[model samples]
Target chain A: AQSVTQPDIHITVSEGASLELRCNYSYGATPYLFWYVQSPGQGLQLLLKYFSGDTLVQGIKGFEAEFKRSQSSFNLRKPSVHWSDAAEYFCAVGAVAGYALNFGKGTSLLVTP
Target chain B: NAGVTQTPKFRVLKTGQSMTLLCAQDMNHEYMYWYRQDPGMGLRLIHYSVGEGTTAKGEVPDGYNVSRLKKQNFLLGLESAAPSQTSVYFCATAEQGRNQPQHFGDGTRLSIL
Candidate 1:
């Protein structure tokens, strides 16, 4: 079975500050990983995904995540987060058998002025 | 394009009541999924379909049923609603591949009172 873990429950950052959200997964083999963002009253949007490519993957809205096999981590990062970046972020892993995704408990981000 | 849409953006159900949530996608995707989102728990897959007329159970499939009678639509049913089933439900679709991004719909906020 595949599982994902997000260490942070909530994160607060000021406008123009950098942001990073941690994500770790437990899977037997190299698995598909993804980052998704959910805003208030809206559906989730894909931030980025990692399959078998470069270790650093870029995503929408100036977000990026690195896949580190040694640490079993795929942490999302942003150089400078805007106020609009405040939202809930989720990390997910997928198995090859049925394309079912195992998601982590999301990290709620709050951007302050 | 209305990438993915879910009907009944909000609903309140009493215990033991039965209802179905409809999800439609305009992207001609071959894979669809149903997931429940709780307060602290991210998104748990309830059911999924690889294609039309093919339904499969996910991480948490008990007390829930899904149908994909059409390639563009997927429906999730709750035979007897329970308080524990009260949560936001999201529908997602993706291309049939290893690492395709899954598009989501604005969730249905279902409250089982």
Candidate 2:
């Protein structure tokens, strides 16, 4: 069985400040990792995905995440956040041959002016 | 292009009431899933379909039934609504293969009183 853990439940950051959300997963093999963002009253949108290749993957909205195998972590980072970036973010992991995904509890981000 | 679309964006049902949530996708994907989102809990899979006429239980598959009569449609039914079932429901679809990303719908906010 696979599971995901997001250490942060809520985070507040000022506009133009850097932000990082922690995510950890427990999987047996190389896992397919993904980051999704959800705005208020909207569906989730794919931020980025890491299947294989570069350790660091860039996503839409200037967000990026690095896959650290040794630490079993895939944290999402943004150099600077905007006021419109206030949303909930989730990290998910899928098996190489599986048909479903396991998602973390999610981190709610607040961008203040 | 409209991706995954879930019908009845919002619904309020009473206890013991039965209703069905419809999920339709135009991506021609091979896999579809139903999930529920609650406060402080990430999305938990309720049921999923690998293809037409095939359904399988997921992480949290209680008090719910699912059917996939067409490859583009997946229906989630609640035989008896309960307060615990009041949450946002999401539908997602993905192509058949490893490392594929799942696209999500805007979600349906179902409140059971």
Candidate 3:
């Protein structure tokens, strides 16, 4: 079984401020990780993914995440967030056994200007 | 190109009713997935297909049925809708490998009374 945990349910950040969302995953095998973003009433969009690569991976919309195997974490970060960056973000874990993504409860980001 | 398209963007159904949600992908993907999103629940996989004619249960598949008769289409059916099933449903497709990112549709908001 694979699972992802996002400790922050909701977070508010001032515009232009740095932001970091924590994600922890548990899987028995080597895991493939993903970060997805979703706007209200819309489906999820891929923010980034990590399979077998460098620990630090950059994604679109000025987002990045670092995979820390020792900590079992993949936390998403942004140097600066814009008003439009407010959305629901999810972290997922997958492996070759089933190839199914198990997503976390998500973190709601609110950017305050 | 429409990355992924789900039919009936919104629907309301009474308890015990049945309906099928259609998902089609233009990207010639080898994998397709169905997921439900609820507040504080993030996204839970309902069912998934690795290829045409193959369907498997995911994290949550008790109330859902899925079929993949064609490579480009996956259908999720709710045989007996319940209030617990009222949530937004999303369909996604991925390339042939485990590391490939999954592209998603706009989602279908299904409300069951």
Candidate 4:
């Protein structure tokens, strides 16, 4: 069965600090990877996705993710996190042209100035 | 623009109560999905629809029923609610493409007592 794992349950970072959210997946083949962010009382927004071609994919809101095929991981990163960047981050994986995705447990990010 | 919308932003229910969560999208998307978010569980797909009048089960479809009678609407029903069913429900939509990312709506918070 395909599954996504996010090791960190919570992460706290000071404003302007860099951020890294780890994600690992177990799938028979390379899957489409995605990163999403959810704010308080809000729906989730897609930060980025990795389908093909580039391993390092850039996304909205100054976010980026690298898909490592060898490690079966798609990690999200940001150079400097703002207070507004504080939100719950989720990692997901799905088959090519698949209908649904398998999501991780999510990592709650807290930005403090 | 209302990309996607889920009605009943908040609700409380006792065991065995039945309620339907409605999801509507105006983007003329061919794909609509329902997911449930829980503490330490990120988001799990409950049901999805590929187009009008077509519904399918997702990863965690148990205890939930769904319908997609109209092209822009998807409905999730909990026939007999349970405490374990308490979760924040989200609706998302995507164009019928191979690598399109989904757009989400503000989630509906449901608490089952």
Superposed on the true interface residues, model 4 gives a C-alpha RMSD in angstroms of 1.6
Q: For residue B22, give model 1's deviation from the true position in Å.
A: 0.4
Q: What are the per-residue Cα lDDT tens digits for candidate 1 across B46-66?
A: 999999999998889999998
Candidate scoring better on lDDT of 1 and 4:
1
Instruction: TM-score each candidate.
Output: 0.97, 0.97, 0.96, 0.95
Candidate 2, B1-113: lDDT as tens digits: 89999999999999999999999999999899999999999999999888899999998899999999999999999999999999999999999876888999999999999
Query: What value does the lDDT take at residue B23 in candidate 2?
Result: 99
What shift in Å separates residue A95 of candidate 2 from its native position after superposition? Answer: 3.7
Which residue pairs of candidate 1 clash?
Answer: none
Candidate 1 chain A least-lDDT 10 residues: A94-103
Selected candidate, larger DockQ, 2 vs 4: 2
RMSD of 4: 1.4
Clashing pairs in 2: none
TM-score of chain A of each: 0.97, 0.96, 0.96, 0.95
lDDT of 1 at A46: 90
Query: Higher lDDT: candidate 2 or 3?
Result: 2
Give the Å error, residue B13, model 3. Answer: 0.6
